[model samples]
Structures are given as structure tokens and as C-alpha cells.
Target: MTLLEQLGIKHPFLLAPMAGVSTPELAAEVSNQGGLGSLGLGASTASSAREQILKTQELTDQPFQVNFFCHQPAVLDAQIAQQWIDYLSPQFQKYGATPPEQLNCIYPSFLDNDDFLNVVLETQPKAVSFHFGIPHAHQIQALKAAGILTLVSATNLAEALAIEAAGIDVIIAQGIEAGGHRGIFNETFDSSVRTADLVQLIKKHCQLPIVAAGGIMTGQQAKVLLNLGADALQLGTAFVQCKSSNANIAYRKALFDQPITQITASISGRPARGLINHWHMQIDTPERPQVPAYPYTYDLGKQLHAAAVQHNDHGFGAFWAGSNVAQIRELEAADLINQLVLEMNFA
Candidate 1:
């Protein structure tokens, strides 16, 4: 069956769930329009996840996906975290502020959050997806028992094989051009295999459905991936400029203006693609200090942003986007989906 048939959605596209950018309203509108919408719960607490899920349910009876980060929890290091704070003190001073006295881990990893699992089980969204890594076998079984269709992102064939072996329902074949955190298992990136290549690679070895993601901004691009063996497409940057997204003015402006783009780990201590802003420029140098893992480094980065925003500067914010963000349009979510459908049909 087609993915849309399985999900009972009208379109063959899925909104790439962005943890901070996605909203229940956006997800609802997309799902209501016959494409699957997703709520990213990677950074959310169990309580917030419940609230968001309930809210999305309120907005649409159509199926929507919920996404989580299944990565290992950040290992807190007081010395290194302090060093990070010290390293960014100057930038903090630029906005007349000081970094938090101590960095704190903001979000709990799903691997460690039983409450989140319970929330998922109780809420029972039609689809559940993971990034960074897959959940445990028992967790997977539980989710399946609850009738949730499972998906996980795989950047390379090895990761794709792992996902298939783990009995996942669908594989999100994420390419190097995909924005935000990559779904690589080891967090070490080898950008040689891009989206289309990865999609073909995964299709050759695994029978699981493949959802192609990367710099897919237009319908023609989506058609190419579909022709290359992708069962569906997941678009992140293309939806950021939508009215339902949470992208701020600075991020929207940066997308519209086409700032220098690069992949940097300074913002979140993970290789995420975004506009090259002051934050990236300052920390992407070879001489930059080693950042603490995953979310530990993310803490201070947010603090720096809070300070910068006080002075009307948002270059410190995490304005993540794919390589094709330069072509984003400022349309509503439903309209963008309709246009993409038209483009794909013509292509």
C-alpha cells in the first residue's frame, strides 16, 4: 500500500518534524490537508508532550506523527561546561549579560524517560519516529503493541540496515543536506552518500518503506527522489517559512536573505545545518574549543541567544535549514503542500 494509503492521508509528503519549529497547529493543518504532519517532541517534557498531543488531536482527527530523540543522554562535565561558559563570556558581554552560573541539561533523552514512553503509549499517535538512534527492543515492541507505526532516520546504509533489522515500519533516508541534527547512529558524519544515493542504497538492501529527506524544496525535486525509489518525501526547510511554523522573524529573514550556510556543532554540539550567523562564525574556527556532548553544550548556546536577543541580535539563535533553504517560500502549510503536489504531478 502507498504510505498515504497506510496513513489515510491525501498526499505523499510528510513534514520533517522540527523540535523547536514544529507546532500542533502546523501539524494539524498539514494532516488535515491529507499529508502527514508531525510534532517534534525531542526537547519536550512528558507533560508538554501530552499537552501538545492533546492540542493536535483537538485540531484534527487526521493522523499525525510524533518525533523523539532516542540518543544517549548528555554526560555532564562541570569543568568543561564551565570552560564553555568562559569561552563565550565575551559574546555575552557584547549584549551586556553573563552566562548562566552553571550549565544544565535541558531535555531528557527518550532512552531515559519512562514518563515519555508512558505518554506515548497513552496518547497513541498514529505514527512515532526517532532520530539519533532507535529505541530499545522492548520499547519498540510496546509501541507496536499500541498500534503505532514506527520510523527512524538513517543517514547511511549501515544505519539503514540497523533500522530495518530493528523492525521499524519506515526508514527516513536522511542525506547530508538535511537540516538540523543528523540521524547518524555514531554521530560521526561521512557526507559522501547524499539523499538520493542513500535512498537508492537503502532500497536495494531493505524492503522497508523509504522516506527521502534532504534539500527537497520543490515538487520537481520530490519527484526525482520518488523516481529514485523513495516511497515519500520529508521537507523541513520548505515548511519553516509557513505561517504555522515557529520560526521567528530573524530566522525567516535569514532564510529569505540567503545567508552563508554551514554545518556546525557549536550551537548544539551536534552537526546541524543552519544559516551561517555570528554564532556559527565565532565558534566554527579550527581553534574553537571542544564542546560538551549533545545537550550540555546546547544549554549555554541558548543562554547566549537570550542575551543576544536582548540587544536585538538573533544571530546566536539556532536557525536550522537544509541546503535548499534559499528557495523557501512564505506560504501557509496547506498552500505549500498543494503547490508541491502540483509540482510533483507536472514533473
Candidate 2:
């Protein structure tokens, strides 16, 4: 059977689970249109994640995926975090807000959080996907026992092999062209392979279904990946302009009106692609300090972003996007899905 048949979906499109972007309304619209919609629970608490899942269920009976960050908790150095805050204080001052006295990483680990796991079990989503890394064997066994199909992102052949060996049902082949944080397993972001190359490599090495991602915006691009042996296509930036996305005015306007550039590990200590802005330009200075790791660095980043937003500044926010963001359109989720399906059908 085809991968879509196994997932019980008619279309080969899967919405990328973008934190602060994919809302329940968007997920429902895509699922209701016979495609897989996803809710990103990476930055959310168990209660919020469950609430989003339940809300999506209320809107559609179709199957959808819920994604989590299976990230290990980073050990924060008080000195380093304080240094970051000190460096960012000037930006805060410009906005007339004082930085928090002490910075804290507010994100909890999904691996250790039983509450989040229990909610997943209760919701029994059609698929559960992981970014950053895969779970332990016992955790994988538990999810499989619950009959939840699994998917994970792989940046290289080694990570792809690891996911297949761990018994994940499908692989999301995320290329360097993908926006946001990469899904490399314990590897630096610089090691990520391009999508076109990674998809072809995985097809030769793994039996699991491959879903190509990154830099895919139009029907012609989607057709290129699908024809290259991708069982499905996962798109993030393409859907950012959809009406249901939780993108604020600044973010959506940036997508439509601005040009994006690739930056290497300057903001989040992990390489990410987004629109060029004042924050990135300043951070790129010769005197810029080393960034803290993952969630720890992200905490300080969020504070700066909050301050920026309050002052109507777009420079500090994490406005992530893929290489093909220029092709994005302001359409409703259902209409976008319909157009993609029409393109795929005729291609």
C-alpha cells in the first residue's frame, strides 16, 4: 500500500508543524481538505498542546499529525546566560524595557514529561513526529504499542539510517534549504545536507517512506521532489501566508514584502534561514559574543523579540522561512491545498 493509504489520507501533502505558526484552525482546514495537517507542540505546555489537539478534533474528523521536540534538556551556565542578557540589554533599553533580572529556559523536555505523553496517548493522533532527535527504545516501543505511526526529520544519511533503525514509520528528509531549526541528531546545524541530495540518498539506503521538505513552494517544485521518489511533500513556508497561520502582521508582511537571507548560528546557536533584519546585522558584528545553546539561547532571544514587538520592531523575532519564500501567497488553507492537489494531479 502507498504511504498515504497507510496514513488513511487521499492527498500526499503534509503541513509542516511550525511553532507559533500552525494553529488549530489551519490544521483543521488542511485535514478537512484530505491532507495531513499538523499541530506543533514543541514550544507549548501539555495543557496547551492537548487543548490545540482537541480543538482540531472539534473542527475535523480527518487524521492529522501532532509534532514534538524530543530535545534533551541543555545544561545552562549561569555566567553564559547572564553574559547574553548583558549583551542584549542595550536592545532592551532602546525599546524602554528592562531585561529580566535572571534568564530562565522555560521549555520542558518532552522525553521526561509524562503529562505530554499521556495527552498524546489520550488523543491517539494518527501520527506523532519528532524534531531534533528520536526517543529512546522504550519510548519508541511505548508509542508503537499504542499504535501511533511515527515520523522524524533527517538531515543526513547517518541520521536517516538511525531513524529507520529506530523503527520510525516514515522519514522527513529536511534539507539545508529548510527554514527554522534543523532536525539533525546531536549534530551541528552546519552538517545538514541539501534536500534534493538528501532525498535521493535516503531512497538508496532506507526502506522507510521518504517525505521531502525544504525549499518547496510551487507545484513544479513539489513535482520535482515527488518524481525523485518522495512519497509525500512537507511544506512550511508555503503555508505561512495561509489565513489560518498564527503569524502576526509583522511576520506575514515580512514574508510578502521582504527578502530572506541565510545566517549561520548567529541568533539561536543553530543555523536558520529568515528575512534579513537589524537584529541579524548587529549580531553579525565582529565583536559579537558566542551564542548559548538551543532553549537557553532561545529564552533570551524571545525576551528581545517580545520587547521588539511591543515597540513595533520586527528585527528581533524568529521569522523563519525556506529558500523559496518569495512564492508564498495569501490564500486560505483549503484553497492552497486544493491548488497543490490540482497541480499534483495534472503533473
Give the candidate number with the greatest lDDT.
Answer: 1
Q: lDDT per residue, candidate 1, 246-330, as tens digits?
A: 9898888889896456888889877888888986678677778877777878888898899889889888989998988878888
Q: What TM-score against the true fold does each predicted structure earn?
A: 0.97, 0.96
Query: How do the residues 1-347 of candidate 2 rate in per-residue lDDT, one tens digit apiece?
Result: 89999788888899999988999999989989998999988889999999999999999999999998877777777787777778888988999989887766766667765777788899898998999888778778878999999999998998899999999999999998898878866735456688999999999999999999999877778888988889999988988888788988888889988857565565665567787777678876778776777777777778888888887887887888988788887788888888887877777
* Alpha-carbon runs more than 4 Å astray in model 2: 187-189, 264-266
Candidates' lDDT values, in order? Answer: 0.88, 0.84
Off by over 4 Å in 1: 189-192
**Cα displacement (Å) at residue 252, model 1:** 1.3
Q: Candidate 2, clashing residue pairs?
A: none
Give the backbone clash total of model 1. Answer: 1
